[model samples]
Target: MAHTTERPVREREDASIGELLSAVTSDAQKLFRQEIELAKAEVREEATKAGKAAGMYGGAGFAGYMTALFASLAIVFALANVMDWGWAALIVTAVWAVAALVLYMMGRSRMREVSPKPERTVQTLKEDAEWARHPTR
Candidate 1:
């Protein structure tokens, strides 16, 4: 069976003002619902991307830590042949301390470059709310 997919395009032109207003209200409601659905889908898509990126960062961090541990072990063993084991351990500890200090300094510098607040997004949302309530102003 062929299903009819048509909207009533024939307007009475004589439609009462109340009828027109009712139709407008219905269409606006439908449009609002559709906008909400679209926003929800967009947020879901963005969240999925954020989750994947976070997982990738976590994996990279884990691999970096493992590499550092193994390399430290190898270095200590190699240095042990040239010096006492205690001295080799001390050298490795000193190197790690220096690396940690360097990382802390760089992290602090980068944090200074980042904004702590969502300034633009907050402003835009406030403007949208204002326009919605008082469209002309």
Candidate 2:
């Protein structure tokens, strides 16, 4: 005869209702904790993206200020002398303007990528709510 580990149907059915409820409660608590952890991870990732976007904006602002400063100096020097130092200063100003534009574009792109809401967590929580409503499914 083969050895068997299965409990008899009568013995299985004898499990107390309190025991079953306790097991369900324990599992629910574990699931809740896991969901919380997932949400935190998602939020952290989004926050990091937002921080990068903000930094890019700061860099763009600095570049814009430099562009303005250089352009003013270029204009003053050009009025003083139209040929040598003036042209050089104007070239430098143009370079700063280009840098400022590039930085602004990069910051805009990064800002677009950032999302304040945690999308994945929202979707999962919605699913969890549905499951809570119809757990047997």
Per-candidate clash tally: 0, 0
> Each model's TM-score, in the order given?
0.51, 0.69
Give one digit per residue, the lDDT tens place, for model 1 in 1-137: 98843334255476677776677577658756765665566566656655655555555556456646876789899999999999997888677666655555554554454443444445555675687688679
* Candidate 2 segments exceeding 4 Å error: 1-12, 70-80, 83-102
Error of 1 at 106 (Å): 14
What are the lDDT scores of the predictions, listed in order?
0.63, 0.78
Global fold similarity of model 1 (TM-score): 0.51
lDDT tens digits, residue span 1-137, model 2: 99854443356576677766666677679888988898889889989998998898897897689767866685757655656776666676677778888988888898898877778878988998899899889
- Index of the highest-TM-score prediction: 2
Question: In model 2, how large is the Cα lDDT of residue 110?
Answer: 87
